[model samples]
Target chain A: MSWEIIKQSLPMFQQGFLLTLYLSLIGIIGSIIVGIICSLVEYFKIPVLNKILKVYIEISRNTPLLIQLFFLYYAFPAMGIKMSAQLCGIIGLIFLGGSYMSAGFSGGFNGVNKKQVESGKAIGLSRWQLARYVIFPQGFALSIPALAANIIFLIKETSIFTVIAIPELTNTALDLIGLYYNSNEYLFVLVVAYAIILIPLSIILTLLERRVRYGTFGN
Target chain B: MAHSGINVLFEGTNLTRLLLGMWTTFKIAAVAIIIGLIIGIILGILRTFHNPILRFVLRIYLEFFRIVPTVVLLFLFYYILPRQMNLHMPGTQVAMLVFSLWVAAEMSDIVRGALISVPIHQKESGLAIGLNKFQLYRYVLVPQAVQLELPATINLITRVIKTTSLLMLISVMDVVNIGQQIVEANNQKYPTGVFWIYGLIFLLYFLIDYPLSWWAGRLEKKRLEQTNGE
Candidate 1:
């Protein structure tokens, strides 16, 4: 409960905070890309790719992210393919978040009315144009709330990267605990740091979800 | 060059140890899910009551659990409580508490949604028949909510089971911990077997979870069809 020790560990915490942000940014971008690609593969019903994605999503969704991280960080090295823990942790997070996001995005895609797609076809738009103009926007709108919720889950899951010795927020707090022998103080700051980053995103998500629900994905 | 993966399991008590760990995983997850769902059903009912202060407090409780990472909560209970508050519990028990609280948060949300979705006219009709609050809920609301909540609650069971993997991080002897132990013991002789060993861990989880997920989907579809027909 000493402020002096907590102050001394502030620099370490700052560094960890930065790494957490970096990891989450990569996770968000990678998951969105992976999610969109998976959805597209499903939407078009690409035979081989869709089958692969089905298996990927099934396994990814069913397993815990921690075990998935172990597979990449610990298992791959045994197979003669070594990766840095940071690299493996981020990749694991992407795969974990991406599977869930793909499911959410596909829900949004399916929410697009069938008649709207038929009308788009009647308008003689190319399939690519049809998706780009008609489907993607509507689907993205419908998915905003689900996407936000998934992002929040992803943010919380990022804390698990510490188990792999990545110096994310949680690990940094643990490190500080070791150095300062004050688990209470360090974990307090750690919780605050995570909340500061997450709460605003959640608020924005709720607002956006409400707006979208009211049928005003504004022009 | 690595040793044979099959030999690692048959090499004395390794397989027995792993199966025991798997049993522990199931035991802890089952206890947590049941307790969480029971607590959640109560809170969910409370959440729908027309009391602003009660609803507000419930929201805070749910949001706090949802916002915190599971690992942090586990640490707070497993490490901090013992050291600071002199509240010591076994690692497995702590894991159960952490997960049960999380599951309760999730279950409460599901329950609230199902409860709210019950038609308003049903409640009105119950009141017209001179039913008390207890009788109304027992006869009308709880039954309807169960139909809506069953599939989502099944899905939550799969989630709780998968989350038990996190217990390994806290040094609980769950299946993943056993996998790690096997890898550590055999690292020198059978380095390549890490792939198969972890793959086996993945398959074990998939066996437990995939069927539940499939069943949940089927239940959800049936519920939807029933509602549509009605």
Candidate 2:
């Protein structure tokens, strides 16, 4: 409501925004890598790893990221494993994001046409060759929309890093409100800052989805 | 040290307190889902109609909830609403309000998708059979849609339950919050208790959510089998 509070808080919000961006970017990339490996393991029917991944996915998906962060930040230290808040935040994001992403990717992998795999096999392509030439591209393309949704979900999730004292955007806003009692202004700035980051990112992802769809299907 | 961590859980009323906190979480989620389901059904039915303005408004509502993080929304409602609107609600109520609105937005989409997926011939057949619009939906459309909607609705319920964990941020003392309190209280005496406390919270959530998810998957599979058989 007041420009004065908004003006004074912009710098802090900017710093918080950068941290959020950095955390989300790393989280997004880390999860995607984890997702790819996990999905591939499932796709190939790896024995021991497949069972472990299943349990991992179920546990990760069912629990909230906040609880996971709490366990990492608070509990791990007691168990003689020390991690900074930022590291805990990143690990939490990947831990949560990986399961969802793997679900999406595996859906794509399973949805790959049966006839295509057969044809690749008939053409004398090796297993690795078939996966490289036949499965991965189509599955990746098919997974794009789900991947985009997960990316946005991960970004929004970064808001909770405040609980671990990471000083992200939500934390900055909370801190400002605590110090100044100017809830309206700080919340307004917080919302606008998120809009600034998320709106454009969503638009870009949507565009990327469209581009991939058209590129792959020629529709 | 290993045994001490496990011992902390059974010490005093720590275990009971955690279960009570879990109950509070379930209560909030249950109330929110019920309220959200009622409103969402109406909004979803409205969305099926050819009303441009209503559709646009509903889209905005859905997008608003989709874009904003749940934590931020909780903070907005819990902190700002009392100051701006002079409404002093408890944190539990505020959490319920925000979550209900969120669930409603999500549920409406699920409902809309299920409703729209019902073939057009079913509605036309109902009209030709002397059924009025209300009866058409009640007898012909909704029953069919219910089968399609149930699995997704169950999934949404699980989502709502998981999200209720965020209520701790507003100081609603859900299971996670209680776990944190227990850990802090026992820090010196049972310094390794943190692992056990949080691990139990994690397992508790898994126990509650996994069954629902499994049920939803079974229903979805059954639906698929029925459709494929037809």
Candidate 3:
């Protein structure tokens, strides 16, 4: 309610916000790579790798990301594979985001027209070339909206890293509240900060979805 | 390396503790889902009503709830609400409130999508056959939209169950919290118990969620086939 508390807390919140941004950026990129690899594994039916990826995807998608973070942060250390909370959190997000993105990308991959694949073959395009040139383009275009949604979800999921004490935005807010016992003031600012980032992202995603739905692509 | 902690989860009260945690998880998730379904149906039906201001407000409500992390929402409702409003309540109750709000937002979207997907001619034909607006909705639109929305609602049910894990973060002593406690308690007894405990929790969630999701998918496919046939 008061601007004084907000003024005092601004620096901490800003730092936390930047850390969240950094984590989300890394998560988004890493997960996209993971997603593409998953889709490729599925597309080619890569023997043992495909089966492993399917189980990974199933486990990641079904279980809560909180438990996943706990497994990586708490369980790994118990097994003597120690890592920083930030690293574990980001890795968790990547795995989680990748699993969700795999679903979207597979839907897009299946949507690539059969005739298009036939035409590529008729043109003597090799299997790799057919996938790289003809298939990836249309598949990615078809899947852009779902991909954006996954990115947004990943960004939100980064908030869970606070559980492992990663000092993200939510953690920073809680820390401030702990220090000042000003839950109402700090929590309001916290929600606003999240909304400030998320609302614009959601709007952009909405526009992107509309464009993709209208068949606007690399034309 | 051998897992010295293998017996931590399987031995004695450890398994009982984990089961109790699962019971709490199931209990809370069930309450939240049922309450959420009722609230969601009402909100969803409200969303279908023709009012611009109401629609705009509902849009903002849905967008805000959908965008905010469940963890944050849990903190706000469980921690901040009591502080801000001077209305103290149990964490479990606050969790139910926050999650029901979330489920309602998600469910409204599902219902809205289903309503939109229903063919316009179906409604028109009902009107032409002398059905009043109430009769049109009751007899024609509601049935079809509910059918279309069923699988998505079931999907949301799985989501609701999964999200109940967040309650642990708020100190609600759900399955994850109980698992963590068990691991911590026995960490000294068997230094590698964390892996087994969390892995079991992960498997527990998978066992619960996978079948529901599979059923949702199957229902969706069946609905698709029926529509295609029609």
Candidate 4:
């Protein structure tokens, strides 16, 4: 393997890294919002929506992310709507991420003290106001560890977007590696590239989770 | 391409192809679950130890496995492990290795979580009843931990099943591979074979997964009812 050639191509690969970051950032933020909403819908026990949301979460959660990507990428366009690959990938990620978020957020919701809700009601708060002011913060704090784990999972899963031909880190690495008869060099480089992205993210997640756990305990 | 051509896809052997796909999928899933459960439990306990070096080593193992995507992990074991280490195994064996490590890491986390979830009071109560520490764990702790662990364990099983699809990317002749091959073979006769072929695979996964998942939800619900009943 020519170190010089790889050294030169590093810029292109760096661009791919940016794309992966962009995709994951958008996916995480969008899905967290989606997840919180889904959790609330479940938490408040929406009458007709309760069953619909439950089934939706189940389907999204049970199947593989890859199949979901395929559905979004291949199935949707055939129905006469067009979307960019990145959009499809993001949407797919959000769908999976959102479902996961519901579980964590709801778990956190359940962790909130029952007294807190009762007190809110005692104070003559409307349901929405009680949920917004009293319930969400406590629920959010309690579910932080589980929520962080899901976000970390979302980061790891972003690599699957490579299948839909997004030039993210995994795809970029695989592209370069595929050219080489020496598969070992490529695989190592790919693994290192992954470690570079994931390890720091893992540390950040751990620290965030610990901090959240501390706050929850203090409360 | 747009709306799924699922109807055309499952026209004839839809049921058979789905069953075949699931048979293969579940075979991999079944093996992975059993092996993953064993490995996860061992490592989880290893992680709970007071030994600094051992804890550090297990932490690194857990983080490494957790960080690497299963697809990349599979590729490492399938392509590079043999070249660098001369440990040549069949694709299935290589996949088992990659997934076992993955399973081990995640399961260990679950095990750790379950163990911790058994209230500290419960263990103390056992002690108050004159039970020793190890005896307290064996008798008072493990069962409750198992109950909490069941749902998460089911989630892991579902994950392993879904992940097995990535095996096809590396030419593993899995359910996806089989579907692709048949689709390609019939491509000349029907231009839309890819749709039906893959769609069939999708249904197969749903068929296999939905029921087990329903059971898991039921377990969680039963837990709730029991707690409510109490």
Candidate 5:
């Protein structure tokens, strides 16, 4: 409500915002790489690694990121595996996000038609060639919507990094409220800041989804 | 380092306290989901109406909840509402309130999708059979939609249950908070206890959530089979 407080707090919020953006970017990229590897293992029906990845995916998907972060940040120190809060936050996000992304990617992999694979084989495409020319592109196209949803979910989840003392936007707003007691102004800024970040990202993803849906890659 | 980390869980009433905390988590999630389901059904039915203003308003509500993180909303209700509106509700109640609104927003969309997915011929057949509006929905539309909505509803229930972990942020003394308290109390005596305490919390959540997810998957598979058979 007050412009004066808003101006005063802008720098702190900017710093928090950048941290959040940085962490989310790292989390998204890390999870995508993880997802691709896991999906590939599943698609190829790799023996021991497939079973291990399955259990990892199940445990990761079933647990909340908050508790996972608690385990990493607080519990690990006791086990002589200390990590910085930022490190914990980054690891926790990828640990959680990777499972969800792998599920999405595998769903896409399953959706790639058997006929397509057969035709690729019929055309003398080797195993790697079959996957490269036949499966990955179509599967990636099919997975676009799921990937977008997981991205949004991961971004929103970064709010909880505040619990481990990361100075993300949520943490910054709480700090300002604790200090100034201007809960209205700070909360307003928090919501608007989130909206500003999330709304455009969602719109862009939707556009991306549309392009994938109608584009020639899948068809 | 001298003692095992597992000792902390069995020592004193730590285990009992953690179980009680899990109950509180369930209590909050149960109340929120019930309230959300009732309101969401109403809103969803309204959304199926041809009113432009109502549709627009509902869309805004859905998008707002979807875009904003649950933690931010928790802060708004728990921190801001008391000072701004002179409301002095407890943190648990505020958590329930925020989660209820969120679940309602999500459920309404699910309901709307299910309702519209019912073929137009069914509604027309009900009308031709002299069924009034209420009777039409009760006899013809809702039953069909309910079947379609069941798997999605189960998935939502699992989501709400898992999300209750956030209640600890508001200092509601849920399972996670209680675990933290146990770890703090036993830090000297059981230096490795933090791992066991949080690992138990993680397993507890997995036990509660995995069954529901499995059931939802089963329902989804059954529905798929039925549709493919038809």
Candidate 6:
């Protein structure tokens, strides 16, 4: 709990913060790609894959992120593929985040008027063109708020990566706690790190969403 | 490239460990759900109470739980809370307390939202029928509110069960912890089964979650059908 311990550990803590940022950045990109692809398949009305993807989305979204991480980090090694805990953690977050992203995006698509699609068809847009110009643009705009929330969720979910030995913000805090063995010394500071990582990001997301929703495109 | 270094899980020799982990997972899930449901109901009602003070308290409580990550909360409860307050409690016990408090707040919000969505006409009709406010809420409001809330309620159940995995990080030896144990023990001996162990855990979760989601879907469909029929 001493200032000396906290001061000395500053660099250690920063390294962990950097790790969290790196993992979350990669995870967010991977998840958004997976989400967009899955959403397109469902929106395009793919027959069999639609059913599988629907089931995938439901199961992944309903289960906790912790369980998903554990299954990949702890259980996968037994199944024969040797995965580092960090890789397991990252992949699990991507899958979990992607599934949630798809759910929100699908809801956005559902919110779109069916006539919008028909109008695109009438304009002689190919399926890809229709999706890019007419469908996805609109759905992405509508889904932005929810998508922002999902990114926040992804940030928090990454905290659990500590259990799998990934050197992220939470693990750094826990490691610091272990070293100090004093709750007040590092615990509250860790909470601040978490808040720091999330709050501004969320605020910026909200402002950006409002801007997009109400700026020129909205008109 | 030949994969090596994980032996204990896939060799099929540690069936007992997997079963043990599975049993522990179920046990924690069962207790967590019961705790979650009762508290969730009370908190739900608390958020809607007439007292502004109570409502404010509930709002703060909800916001705190909503934004804070569960793992951080778990670490606080398991590692910090007791020490700061001078209590000596076990990890699993603290986990229950922390999760119950958190889940209650979430469930309460869901319940309140569902209750508010009930048509105003239903309340007016109840008053016209000469039912007291308490009796009206109990018989008329509660039933309809619960029916509307059931799908989300089931969803929260899955969320609670899955969250028990956090206990593993804190050394509670739940299913995930047990899986990790077997993997660590056999990592040198069998080196290849880690994937299967994880795959089983993955399938186990999907297996449990699938039916609940299906049931929620059916409940939602029935609600819609009832609405359409009306």
Comparison by lDDT, 1 against 5, better one: 5
Better structure of 1 and 6 per lDDT: 1
Judged by DockQ cut-offs, the docking class of candidate 2 is medium
Q: Give the CAPRI class of candidate 6.
A: acceptable
Which scores better on lDDT, 1 or 3?
A: 1
Q: What lDDT tens digits, residue by residue, belong to model 1 across residues A16-128? A: 88998999989988999999899999988999999999999998989888888988998888767889999998899999988889988997887676677889999999989
Writing each residue's lDDT as its tens digit, candidate 4 over A148-198 gives: 788779988988898889999778877876775556656666677778877
TM-scores for chain A over all candidates: 0.92, 0.93, 0.92, 0.86, 0.94, 0.88
What is the DockQ ranking, best to worst?
Answer: 5, 3, 2, 1, 4, 6
Docking class of 1: medium
Instruction: Give all TM-scores, in the order shown.
Output: 0.93, 0.93, 0.93, 0.88, 0.93, 0.83
Two-chain DockQ for model 4: 0.54
Query: Candidate 6 residues B75-145, lDDT tens each?
Result: 87887666668787877778778877887888888889887788999989999999997888788887888
Winner on TM-score between 3 and 4 is 3
**Model 1's lDDT to the true fold?**
0.87
lDDT of 2 by residue, B69-122 (tens): 999999989988899899999999999999999999988988898899899999
User: DockQ: which candidate is best?
Assistant: 5
Worst 10 residues of 1 chain A by lDDT: A210-219
What is the two-chain DockQ of model 5?
0.78
Better of 3 and 5 by lDDT: 5
lDDT of 3 at B141: 86
lDDT per residue as tens, model 1, B119-215: 9999999999999999999999999999899998998899889888889867899888898889889878776767777888888899999999989
Each prediction's whole-model lDDT (CA): 0.87, 0.90, 0.86, 0.79, 0.91, 0.78
Better TM-score candidate (4, 6): 4
Q: Which stretches of candidate 6 lie over 4 Å from their true place?
A: A1-8, A51-59, A62-87, A113-142, A200-219, B1-13, B221-230
Give the per-residue lDDT of model 5 (tens digit) for A1-219: 889988899999999899989999999999999998899998888999999998998788888899999999998998899999999999999999998899899878666767788899999999999988889988888898899989999999999999999999999999999998988888888998999889998898879877876764546
Worst 10 residues of 1 chain B by lDDT: B1-10
Clashes of each: 0, 0, 0, 5, 0, 23
